[model samples]
Target: MSQWFQLGLQNGNSPLMEQLTFFHDHALLIVVLITSIVTFFLSAIFVNKFLHRYLLDGQMIETIWTVLPALILIVIALPSIRLLYLIDEINNPALTLKVTGHQWYWSYEYSDFNDIQFDSYMIPTNELEQGMYRLLDVDNRVPLPFNQPVRLMITSDDVLHSWAVPSFGIKMDAVPGRLNQSSLMINLPGVFYGQCSEICGAGHSFMPIVVESISSGEFLKWLESQI
Candidate 1:
């Protein structure tokens, strides 16, 4: 199962996106597992008591209604809280990238490098490929090494915008005068696509994000090209 999880996405080229897709696809399984156990027992109790009971909407029914929902909430809260905290915690990251949300585009700067910066804009519709999505391509691609930990610092040049790449399990707000951070670790080499999530202006939908994950050697070559 772990081996299968490492496979790249059929629609996307990124391995990180594939893992996120799997996580999204299996998310309902967790819901099903918990709901099945809780609902089955609860339904059984409801049917056995309500269908054959002597009274309807009585004191016993009222008491069961109040207590049953609270009990179910407790069961659901345990797992939900654990996942929330886990997502918030940041481990040691190998490198960092700074992303700034501009008025109609995005700028990424490599903090680990010599602050190599580039602007990413939307790909013109005429320039799009068969498999490529328009408004999701960029003029520049952020390059990083495969199978490495990377930290991202996000901020805004104008209004607020959200840097969200669903495949990377990253969504950080880019607020004016403030910086937000997130981290990612890709286990394979490929191009991952994302877009500016917040609605800052008319061109908000046009601002796309493309991240190129390459081999360590290839990443170095790309970095040298930037210089």
Candidate 2:
């Protein structure tokens, strides 16, 4: 969840999200270093009005410029590639969850369990209780146990939509007639919020996503109740 005036990424609740945050910080540091160095050099040249044709165009300087960017890109690309494989690696999920996007709502199916499915709709403002977040609360929140890997399958019944939960580091598109897959394993217990990221129709902003991360025992209780 985010606070007022907050612009940074949300604190991670999953291992993948935590790794993503680390990568973001790592890349940001390198970017700032490059920007600062470039700015200083430009400022020095402009302030002194110094011009040395041979010194500026030296072979050593050219080689350094070319090799430095390549090194930086390699440094960035390695981790990115590793993370991509990690995210795509869905090995023997403990459970399977299917998410279906509609024009104005979402449907969830716990495929591993029998008769556990429901449609999630946004809680209207007039029906909201005290302390409930507006435009983020749903009538039925998808509950899954923490520390358990779940295979997430996403698809759309109608137009394009996106199922994104920032704290969980999930943002998979829901395409019609095609299924996209992802994985989620929350490391903590909390209620995470999200919304339909793609603009589908008039109710695009009204379709909110809520996920309840709970202990295995509590999750079993909820599962039993749902079943």
Candidate 3:
């Protein structure tokens, strides 16, 4: 399971993101199927009838349509609620990383690693190296071990900013004077990218987030270097 993670948008290299992608793909297919079935039958029944002379009154059809959609919504809500609860849950994490959003930069603190701190700055477009994304690359990347459960505690130094990584299926807001927490079990090994979602200041567009997932041995080496 740990060997298949490749860097991309849909293919999640992290456990939490993999689960989220699977849920999103499967649940969305179910919704589309339900919608298609209802639409096909409704169109088949009403298209010819309305064209001919409207055999059924509009009011009667409207009532059925409204009630049927309501019933379909009930079916969709069940799985959605379950996934939401699962996301809200926080398990016993091995490490905790605290992130604080500043005006135009992101500061990361490895709370468990002798209080190691760093600031991540975005690499400018003109200075992007080979295979590097222009606005997505950062000077310092957060490093963590693969196949480990890591918790994040987030807050803001100024206004509101959101920490979001699409492939990781993780997004949390950093609000002023308030702390928010989330956890992720990154099973796959690779790098993931995110950005500041909220507009705080003029340089908000320059801040970026990078998370590097490495093997346990590599993680320990990186930790030692930080100390």
Candidate 4:
């Protein structure tokens, strides 16, 4: 169950997500510092009657303001650009999974193995067992191996949908007649949950995504059973 007072992002389960969280904190710190400084200056002007006659027509002040913002942007931009490239980098994935979004459910295909495919549907609330998460658990959970690179090819069979998992830091659009791809690597073994980000139709919220990361040997055993 999700906590009621959760304030920040979910604990990351992947390396990319860890980096994303770090970047978020880094950017937020800069914003907070800028806001605090600006607020202090404005308060001083009003409260302390601190007014400089040359403030309005000072070239040095204008130059300093302009240069400072430019430098801050550069500081922010460098890491942002690096993260963008890192997310796009595909380093020879060990497994490839094709995901197709339907009007409500999600279908997954393991192309690396022979004849391995399934459809994942949300388990109704009433049918949920003990310890099952409401509206988050699914009938078919996608199994993946920890520490193994995996590639996902996303598309839609009917309407537009988005495949996203916050802990994995992945959100790719699923458009009909178009295949969008993304790569991910789970750093640990656990169950991560996500939902279709795009608002498709009446049942948009019913389609939930669940990924179960296990050991490579266990993943192979599951794959063999599927075949």
Pick the lDDT winner. Answer: 4
For candidate 3, write residues 1-227 as lDDT tens digits.
11256543455766677777776776688788988987997888866544534435577777877898788677777767877887778888888999999888899998987769988889888888999887888988988888888889999998999998777778899999999998887768888888888887888888888999899899888888877
Candidate 4, residue 39: the lDDT equals: 100
Write down the lDDT that model 3 would get: 0.82
Better of 1 and 4 by TM-score: 4
Question: Candidate 4: where is the Cα deviation over 4 Å?
Answer: none
Q: Estimate each model's TM-score.
A: 0.74, 0.97, 0.82, 0.97
Ranked candidates, highest lDDT first = 4, 2, 3, 1
Q: What ranking of all candidate models by TM-score puts the best one first?
A: 4, 2, 3, 1
Give the lowest summed-lDDT range of ten residues in model 2: 48-57
lDDT per residue (tens digit) for residues 6-103 in model 2: 98999999989999999999999999999999999888888976688865679988988899999999999998998899889898999899999998
Q: Global lDDT for candidate 4?
A: 0.94
Over the stretch 111-207, how does candidate 4's per-residue lDDT look in tens digits? 9888899999999999999999999999999999999999999999999999999999999999999999999999999999999999999999998
**Which stretches of candidate 3 lie above 4 Å from their native place?**
1-9, 45-71
* C-alpha lDDT (0 to 100) for residue 22 of candidate 1: 54
TM-score of 1: 0.74
Query: What is the per-residue lDDT of model 1 for residues 34-132, given as tens digits with 9 covering 90 to 100?
Result: 689779878887677446453344888788778987876776566566655655656887788999999889898888778588888888999987887
In model 2, which runs have C-alpha deviations exceeding 4 angstroms?
A: 49-54
Question: What lDDT does model 1 reach?
Answer: 0.76
State each model's C-alpha RMSD to the native.
Answer: 5.8, 1.2, 4.6, 1.1
